[model samples]
Target: MMRRSLTATPGPARLRISLAAQQNGCASGATEVTSARAAIATAQAGLTAAAAADTAARTRYLAATQAVAGARKTMLRVQRQRPYRSARVAHAKSAVAIVTKTMITRRAQSGKATAALTAARTGLSIATTRLAGATSRWKTTCAAVKVTQQKLTGTAPTAELTARAAAISRDVVTQVRATFTTADATTVYGITVHRSVAFAFQRMIDDAKADGIVLSGGGFRTRQRQIELRKINGCPDISTAPASSCRVPTAIPGRSLHEIGLAVDITSGGKTLTAKSAGFAWLKAHADEYGFANLPSEPWHWSITGS
Candidate 1:
C-alpha cells in the first residue's frame, strides 16, 4: 500500500484525499486479515487427524495387552496338564512373551501418537489465537475505514457545502480588528486564550510552576496583529505565504493559530522555550495531559492541536 501524508495544514480537498487514502489502506488490511480464516481451518483439520490417529494407537495398545493376558492364561493352563511339552503348549508360552512385547511396542507408538496429537492441539490453539487477533484488528481497522469514508463523503449540495463552511468560519473567526471579544476570551497566566482552553492552560501553568518550571506565553492575536506580524517578519505574501516561509517564521493573516486563541508561544523566564530549555522539556513530558500539543517545527508553539 502507498502511504501518503497529510499537508501541514490540509484544506477540505486535501482532507478528503488523505481520508480516502486511509480508507484504501484499511480495506487492504481487512483483506489480508481474512486469510487467517483459512489458516484456522487448516489447523483444525490437522488436529482432528492427529486425534483420530492417537485414538487408534491407544485402542491397538489395549488390544495387544489383552491378547498377552489371554496367551498367559492359556500357557498356564497347558502347563498344568501331564503333556505340557506339546508344540501347542510351547507356542502358547511363546505367544505370551511375543504379545507382551507387542503391547510394549504399541504403548510406545501410542505415546508418540499422543505427543503428535498434543503438538497438533497446540498448533490449533496458536492458529485460533492468531485468527482471533487478526479478526479483531480487521474489525477495528474496518471501523476506522467507515470513519474515513464518512470524512471523505461529500453528500451535501455544493451551495450548502459552501454556506456551511462560511458559517463555520464566521463562528470561529468573529472579528479581525482586535483579539477575541471578552465573551470569547479568558485570562490564563497573563495570556488570553479561548475560554474553552483557559482552564486547561491555567492548570498546566500551575502544575509547571509546582515543578519549578515557570510558564509564560503570548496568545490570541487579532487578524490585524497577524497581518502586522507577517509584514514585520517579511512574509512573501501578506495573506497566503506559509509561516515557515517568513523571514521570522510568522503566519499570514487568518492562518495564524494565534488568531484562533488556541495557540501559544510559550516562554520560560520571559524567553521563548527552546530545545535546551527545562521548561520545554517539562511541557514535552506533561503538556498532552492538559490537552496541549506542540508544533514540532517550533518547540515554543503549542495548541490544542499540534498544527
Candidate 2:
C-alpha cells in the first residue's frame, strides 16, 4: 500500500493570501520606521540651516562692529585736524593782505616789495589748496563714520535685516527641537501629550467620552514650540502689550505651564473647545476632579491650577 501524506497542503489561494498578509505587516512596520527617520532627518536639516544662518548673522554683526570702530577713529582724527586746517587758511589770507599793504606803502623799494608780494601770494595759494583738501577729507570721514554708526546700532535697513535674521534663526532652532519631541510623544485621547500626563489625561478623555463627548488634541508643549505658536497667533509679548488687547494670550517660554508637562489643550472632535461647547461644559463641571482646570481666557487651555 502506498503511504499517505500526513499533513494537508494549503491550496494556492490560501498560500497567496497568507503571503500577502505577511508582506503587508512587514511593509507597514518598515514604512513607519522609514517615515520617522525621514522626519528626523528633515528636522536635523532645518536645525543645521538655522545654525548656519545664525553664524553668518553673527559674523556680519562683528564685522559691522569693527567697521564702526575704525570709522569713528578716523572721524575723530580728522575732526581734531579741522581747527588746524582752519587756522592755516586764515593765516594764508592774512599773509596775502599784509603783503598787499606793504606794496602800497613802500614805493621806493617797489621792485623788492613786488617780488616779496608775489612769493607771499604763491604761499597763500598753496596753503588755501591744502586747507581745501583737508576740509574735503574731513567731510568724507564724517560721512563714513555716520554710515558705520548707523550700520552698527541704528534702525537702518541693514541693522534691521540682521536683527530679524538672528531672531528667525533662533526661532527655527526651537521649532526643530519641538518638532522632534512632539513626534516622539505618545498619543492620549487623540492628543499628543507628555508621558507623565498621559494617564491623567486619558482618564479625562475617557470620562468625557462616556458622556458622549470626545476630547481631542493638545498637551505638553516645549518652550520652543510655545514660541512658535505665540508668533503664529501674533500674540504680543506679555512684557510689552497690555493684557486686554492680546487676542491670543500665550505665556513666554519659561513661564508657560505647558513647558512643565502639566498642561493640555483640550478640543472637541477636532474643533476648538469654547465655553459654549459641550466638551468645555463637561470639563468645567468635572475636569477639576481630575486635577484639570480651564484657563479663563483660553477655553481650550487647561492646567493643574487653571492659571
Candidate 3:
C-alpha cells in the first residue's frame, strides 16, 4: 500500500482489474443474447414458410384424391356395360391411374414440408435456450462490479493510517539521506530529487494532498548508497549483482535510478503501498497525470522513466 502501506498487497490492481473485466463481460453477454434472438427470428420465418408449403401440398393432395374417386366410378359403370376392352373404359382406367399418382406425389410433398416445419421449431427452441444461457452468464460476470468500483474510488483512510505513513516516510528519508552527504543533492519536501523532476513531483503531491492522500518517499542515492543496499539486502558481489540476485531486489550500483535522483521508493501510512491501499488506489488512478511511472515489480518505486 505504498499507498495502502498498512492494508494489503494486490488489492488495488485486482479491484480495477475486476471492474474492467466485469464491464467487458456484460457487453459480451448482451451481444450473445442479441445474436440468439436473431437466430430465433430466422427459425420462426423458416417454420412459417414450411407450414404454408405443407398446407398448399395437402390441398393439392385432396383435390387429386377426389378426381381419382370420380374416375373409378366412371370406369366401374363402363365395366358394368360389359365392354372392358372398349376405348371409353380404357380412357376411364387411365384417368384414374393418373390422378392416383398425382395424389401420392402431393402426399409425399406434404410429409416433407411437415418434417421441415418440425425441424424449424426445434431450431427456434435451441436458439431460445442459447439466449437464456448468455443472459445468465452476463449477469454472473457483472455481479462484482459494484464492490470493486467502490474500492477504486477510495474510502477515506483512517487518521492512524495516515500518521503511520508519514512517520515511515520521515524515517526513510533520514536513513536514505545518511547514505550520502545531502549537500550536493537537490532536496524537495525532504526527498533528494533530480532538478528536472522536482516540479512535476511537487505538483503531483500537492494534487494528491488536495484529494486527501499523503505522498512521501526517499530519493537521490549516491553510487555508494547503491552498493550498500546490495550488500545489506544480500547480493554476493554488491557492485556487479543483478537486480534480482539481492534478497530485496537491488539494482546494480551504476544502473540504479536512485543514484541519478530520478526515482523514489514511495510510502503511505508508513508502509510500502500495496495494491489494496487507498493511497495506492489514488496513485494508480492519478499518478500518470503528473508524469510519474511505476515499476510493475515494485509498487513503491516510481520514476520519471518508470524503471
Top-scoring candidate (lDDT): 1
Ranking by lDDT: 1, 3, 2
Over the stretch 1-307, how does candidate 2's per-residue lDDT look in tens digits?
Answer: 0001011234433433443344344334445555555555555555555555555555555555555555555545554674567655555555555554543444334444445455555555555555555555544543443343222222224444444544543453355335445544677645666564465576567657867998886676777887786677676773455434556777766666666555777778779898899999999886754446678988998865565
Give all candidates' CA lDDT scores.
0.74, 0.56, 0.72
TM-score of every candidate relative to the true structure: 0.44, 0.38, 0.47
Off by over 4 Å in 1: 1-21, 86-89, 152-307
TM-score of 1: 0.44
Those runs of model 2 whose alpha carbons end farther than 4 Å from true positions after fitting are 1-186, 238-245
Ten residues in a row with the worst lDDT in model 1?
1-10
Q: What is candidate 1's lDDT per residue for 1-307, written digit by digit as tens? A: 0011212334545655755565556556656667777888888999999999999999999999899889899998888878557887878878998999999999999999999999999998988898888778766765664465444334335455444444443444445324545478777768988886675587578668878999998999788988988888888999788889988788767667787787899999999989889999999987764556678888999876565
Q: Which stretches of candidate 3 lie over 4 Å from their true place?
A: 1-9, 82-85, 150-307
Per-residue error for 120 in candidate 1, Å, reads: 2.0
